[model samples]
Target: MPNIVTLAEAKLFIRVLDDDEDTTIETMIAAATDAVCDVAQAWDGTGEPPARLKLAILSRVAIMFDTRNSLEPGIGEDRLLLPLRTVEL
Candidate 1:
């Protein structure tokens, strides 16, 4: 959870506005964190993981929340994650 955004921050970003959905939001945050790390291809980002990555997580969580069952198509997140991606030959 070192580079992941906190529950409070995610709630605010997604405008949860209440504790009723706290558990669900927490789940989304955890999953989103892992997903972002996978996309970045490295969880060992030095210092902070960068704002774009954090925002990408928030956007993903929002998509998860809105879709209810799965993330929406056309998330267009390559820009947020590609720069941080570690290329492998």
Candidate 2:
């Protein structure tokens, strides 16, 4: 099965995407999706995503990662998004 995504991995991914504005949204979504997928795959050592939550958080993951205002509604004050809480120094 897939492996669980760690905080380090997530932070590193956010860093990598910080440099590429064009692909940030897609990359972040893929990273989050891969993270969940990784966890699912490793859960049973089956190397596959769990079929239980197929269309889970992966759907809105892109929107949460979309820092470029690519979406119309734009990032809101929802607690569902982590980026909204990150404080820059």
Candidate 3:
């Protein structure tokens, strides 16, 4: 599956300018989306990805891009934390 977030959306989130790094950005988007989906168990019940998941994916992608040449990318724990919604039965 392709990334939940679009290339344009990822670019906007990371404030990217030209398309020079588009391939790298696209790769990051796919990886980030996969990570978020895995952590969030996002496909359990969904139409489109929720806003929070999209934000998490975007943030992760930005982190990966910014730290491409450095040490391992460190996405914050908060980004992977899902909100706990209680069910009223």
Candidate 4:
């Protein structure tokens, strides 16, 4: 439910992106999808949860990110993107 990357995975992922710089769009897209899938799998184990539960989890992450980082107050779809900047892992 919560979108998260392991600290090691985040470090490795960023390193690869930084080093490659020219990773294909498809590869980037796959990596994004894999990140989400990793969260979903951990949340439900079966790899799926009810849509409402998924949304609630996502909402919690957004709220936590904004509160924890002091990235502009309030919720907006764009806040989801901001978490990438605020999150440590």
Candidate 5:
């Protein structure tokens, strides 16, 4: 499956310059994309989602990558995406 945010984009966002964590980052990207899309109710998956959705996914990936092993909760993009969410009825 094609990702809205590419691996290169995510690595740059997370300041990961090396390929040592490509697998890990890729996993996070996929997970973040899914979580963001589900939250935004923007799972059309036809092609690149909206820009807002992409931003949300990128933010999510950054947060997850930065807070990988932290005990405290990290910030989220939920509020930013709440306005775009749709009722699932």
Candidate 6:
């Protein structure tokens, strides 16, 4: 599956330099994408993903990367889990 955000973009967001962790970063991106899709209840696996979704994914990836082995890596009050908007009739 194509990622909403590129590895380079994610790396830059997380302030990671060098290609040493490319594979790990890719995995993080995939996980983050899934998380965003799950929360948003959207994503057809094609087309440009929303900026908010991308930002949410990037934020998650950064948190995961920074707190790798911690027993409980806290993510407070995740705004990414906001309910999807609905059209009013």
Cα displacement (Å) at residue 86, model 1: 0.9
lDDT of 6 by residue, 1-89 (tens): 56688999999999988999999989888877776676666555577776777788888788889988642322641554454332346
Encode model 1's per-residue lDDT on 1-89: one tens digit a residue: 57478888988988888899989998888888888878787547668778888988888888888888876522677788888788888
Worst 10 residues of 2 by lDDT: 76-85
What shift in Å separates residue 40 of candidate 6 from its native position after superposition?
A: 0.8
**Stretches of candidate 4 above 4 Å error?**
1-44, 69-89
User: Which tens-of-lDDT digit does each residue in 1-89 have in candidate 5?
Assistant: 35789999999888889999999889988888777766776456786577777788788788788888742323656666777688877
Instruction: Single out the weakest 10-residue window by summed lDDT for candidate 6.
Output: 70-79
Off by over 4 Å in 1: 1-3, 72-74
**Native-vs-model 2 lDDT?**
0.40
Model 4 residue 71 lDDT score: 29
Which candidate leads the pack in TM-score?
1
Q: After superposition, how far is residue 16 of candidate 2 from its true place, in Å?
A: 22
lDDT of 4 by residue, 1-89 (tens): 23333333433433444433333322333344444443333344344444433333344334433354442322443333333323336
TM-score of each: 0.87, 0.30, 0.74, 0.28, 0.80, 0.75
- For model 5, state the Cα shift of residue 74 in Å: 6.3
lDDT of 2 by residue, 24-66 (tens): 4445455555544433332343444343323333433434554
- Candidate 3 vs candidate 6: the TM-score winner is 6
Any idea what lDDT model 6 has?
A: 0.72
Q: Runs in model 2 with CA error above 4 Å?
A: 1-22, 42-53, 57-63, 66-89
Candidate 2: residue 88 Cα off by (Å) = 39
The segments of candidate 3 whose C-alpha lies over 4 angstroms from its true place after superposition are 69-80, 84-89
Every model: Cα RMSD to truth:
1.8, 12.2, 4.5, 12.5, 2.6, 3.9
lDDT of each: 0.80, 0.40, 0.72, 0.38, 0.76, 0.72
